[model samples]
Target: MAQVRNKQVLLKNYVTGFPKESDMEIVEGSITLKVPEGSSDVVLLKNLYLSCDPYMRILMYKDTPLSLGFQYSPGSPLTAFGVSKVVESGDPKYKKDDLVWGVTKWEEYSLVPSAKILFKIDHTDVPLSYYTGILGMPGMTAYGGFFELGCPKKGEKVFVSAASGAVGQLVGQFAKLTGCYVVGSAGSQEKNKLGFDEAFNYKEESNLDAALKRYFPEGIDIYFENVGGKTLDAVLLNMRSHGRIPVCGMISQYNLSQPEGVTNLANLIYKEIKMQGFIVSQFYPLYPKFLEFILPHIREGKIAYVEDIVEGLEGGPAALVSLFSGQNLGKKIVAIAPE
Candidate 1:
C-alpha cells in the first residue's frame, strides 16, 4: 500500500482555567501507511473515534507531571482514548482489519507501540464507535467505581453529580439496574431527563442542601461524587448512616487555582460515610467481568447511551473546550475519519 499521511490536532500551549480554542492547533501530519519491514513492535492504525474527557482538561496544565493517563506536550499531538482500524501490523497479536480501542492520539493515523493498552474489538453487533465512550473507559469507570466501590442494595437511594457526563450517565443507569432509586444533578434540565429518576439543575438550586433534601428525603444511601464543590458539601450533610461515596472525577474543581473546600469532616464521624477515590486503571483486572455484564445489555438495547461527535480534526479544539462550559450533549468525541 502507498504510504499516506494525515491531519492531526496538536497542543499549542499549557492551559490555565477553561481551555480556549487557541490552546490547540490543527496541523497536517503523516504516518507511513505501511509498518517498517521486520519491526515486530509497532502497529499502524487509522483512527476513527477520539474521546474528549474532562481529564484532558487537566492535561493542559503545563507543569503537570506525566501520570497514568495522558499529559499534554506543547507542539505534540493531543493524546486520547480512541477506536481505530488496524491497517498494517508489525505485531503478531494484531493484523489487518482488526478493530481496536485504546489510548490513541487525536489524529487520523497512529503508530501504536504498546499492545498491552490495546483491546481488540470483537463485538461489532453494537456500535464500534462506542469503544470511545460507553463501552470503553466510561463504562469501566462506572462499573468499577459504582458497583465495586459504592455497593448498593435494592431500593437504596443513589445520587450522582454531573449526571449527564460520560461517566455520570452510566453510573446513574447502573444504579437503576441495581434496583436503586437514582437521581442526578446536571447543569441543564434537558440533560436531566436522559436516564435519571429525577434530575435537578444545580444552577437553579438556591440551597444545595435543601435541593438534596427534597430529592432524597430519606437521605442518600449511595453518592457517586463526580462534582466536588458545593455539591459534595451538601451530599456529605445529607448522607444516610453508613452511606457509600465513590469519588470519581471532580470536574468542578479541575480548573481552579485552589480547589473547592468542603468543611464537613465532622459529618463523617456522625454519618459513618464511606468515601473512596478510584481510577479506571485500578480496575483493568475486572474489564472482562465488566464486559460480560455490560455487553449483553448493550447488544439487547436494554442499556442506552448518548454521544456528541464532532467531525474532523479541526473541531478538536472547540470540542474539548466545550466540556468546561457544558456545551456538549453527551460523550464528546472527535471523528477524525469515517470507517
Candidate 2:
C-alpha cells in the first residue's frame, strides 16, 4: 500500500501557565493505510472529528502523570477523543467501514490499539460530530458524575459551575429533568442560556459567595463542581446540610503554577457535606444505561447541545488553546473529515 500524508498537531514543548497556539506545531508525516502485518488487536482508522478538552492541557505539561506515564511526549502527535471510520481491522470486534469513537491522535488517519476504541457508533441517526461532545466522554462525565455521585432528588436545588461547557450544560439539563431547580454559572450571560432555571455571570459578580446566596436563598442541595478555586470556595459556604458535591474538572486551577486554596473547607464538616472527586472512566459500567436514558431525549430534542467546530486538522492547535481563554462559544471540536 502507498503511504499517505498525515498532518498532525504536535506539542512543541512542555507548557507553563497558559497554552498558546505556538505551544503546538502542525507537521506533515506519512502512514500506510494498512494495519501492520501480524499485528493483532490493532485497527487502522480514518479520523473524522477530534475533541478539544481542558484535560488535554494537563497532558501537555512535562513529567506529569496526567499523561498517564508519558503517554504523550513533546514532538509527538497529541492524543484526544475522536470519531473515526475503520479502514482495516485486525480485531474480530471491528471490521472495515465500522464507525467508532475513542482515543485517537490529532490527524486524518491513525493506527491505534483496538482496546482504546471505546464503542462502535451504533446510532448514526444523530450527527457523527456529536460523539466528540454531547454523545461522547463529556456526556458520560456529566451523566455518571451527576447521577451516580451527586445522587440528587426531585425538587432539590442544584448549582453548576462552568455550566456552559460540554459537561456542565448537560449536568444542568439533567438536574432539571430530574425535577430539580437548576442554576448555572458562566462567564457571560449569553453562554448561560442553556435552559437552566437561573444563570449568573460569575465574572460580573463582585463576590461569588454573595452571588450564590442570592441564587439559592435556601442553599444548594447539589453542587456540580466544574470550575474550582474561588467558585468552589463560594459554593462551600452555601451547601445545605448533607449536600453532595461531585467534583469533575478544576479548569480554573489547571493552568496555574500554584493553585488557589479554598479557605472555607471547614464548612464541609460543619454542614456534613459529601464532597467527592471523580474521573469519568470510573463509571463506564453505567454507559449502557446512560445511552438508553439520553439518546431518546436527544432524538426528541428534549436535550440541547452546543458545539464550536473549527475545520481541518490545521486548526487543531488554536481550537485546543481556545478552551482555556473561553474563546470558543461551546464545546470545542475540530472537524478533520466531515461526513
Candidate 3:
C-alpha cells in the first residue's frame, strides 16, 4: 500500500467544564505517504513528541483558539506543539528526514503546510523530545514572560506559581540565573520536586497571602503568574512597590464553569504594580535571541528541565487532562512515535 495508518485522538465533544479521558477518542485513518503531485510546500510528517500544555484546555471548549490559533471541532484530531520528522516534503526548505518542531496534530502521522512548522530542528545534541518542552514553546514562554516582562533584577525576590510546570519551571530558573532569589509553589503532590530555591504547596496553604509573606518577607519584586485566581489575589497583597507581574497562564481557572474572581485587583493600584497579560506569539521575533541566551545555559548544565512523558497516541487525552489536576510533575508530554 502507498498509504500509512494514521492513529489520531479526536475530541469527541466540546468540553464544558473540566475535561475527562472520555472526551477524546482514538480513531484510525489512512494517509498517502507522499505529498500530492502538485502541492507546494506541503510537508508530510511522522509525528514524534507532543507537548501537552494547559492552553490546550481552552481550545477544547467550543468557542476559542489557543496558541496554535484554531478552535477545536468535535470529531477532529486536535493540534498541538510537537516534534516531527519529515517523511516527504514538496518544499525546498525541508527535505526528507529533517527534524522540526511546531504546530502538528495529535496523530501518528500528519500532513501539514510548511508554514505550520516554525523551523527545522538544527541541534541534535539534546533529546528531540526536549523540543516539545524546554527547547521549544514552553521555554520561550518563560523567557519572554520572566526576563522581558517580569524584568528581574539582581537580588530581587521572585515567585512562580505552578513552578514545576513546563513554563514556570523555566521561569524560576531564569529568575535564579538573573541572580534573583526564587520561590515556587506547586500542588501538594508536587511541592517536593526541586527546581527553585524554596518551594511550597499551595494546596496546603490556608491563606495564600500568609504563604507569600512567609516566603518573601519583604515583598516579591517579580511574580511569574501561572495559576491565577487566589494565587494572583494573594500575590497582589504581597507585591513590592513598583513590582512586575507577568501574567502567563490561569490554569486554576481554565476548567471552571464559572471562572473564579480575583478580588485583589485593587492591590495592583495600591502597590503600583505592573500586571501585563501576554501570549507567546509576541515573542517569536526574539526566538533566535532566546535560543542564543538559553542554549549555552542548557549545555553548561546551568539549567534543568523535567518532563513527564506518556508513550503512545492512546495516552494523549489523559496526559493532556492531567494538567488541571496538577498530576504531571513537570512538563507533560505525549510520545507518539519514536524518533
Against the true structure, whose lDDT is highest?
Answer: 2
161-189 per-residue lDDT for model 2 (tens digits): 87889899999999999999999988755
Report residue 24 deviation for candidate 1 (angstroms): 0.4
lDDT tens digits, residue span 242-327, model 3: 99999999999998888889898888888899999999888878888888998898899989998899999999998998888865
- Looking at model 3, the pairs that clash are none
Clashes of 3: 0
lDDT of 1 by residue, 192-306 (tens): 4566799888888999999999999999999999879889999999999999999988888888888889998678889998899887888878878888999998878777888
| Candidate 2 TM-score, true structure as reference | 0.98
Quote the RMSD, in angstroms, for model 2.
1.2
What is the C-alpha local distance difference test score of candidate 2? 0.89
Between candidates 1 and 2, the one scoring higher on lDDT is 2
Candidate 1, residue 332: the lDDT equals 85
Superposed Cα RMSD, model 1: 1.6
Q: Report lDDT per candidate.
A: 0.85, 0.89, 0.88
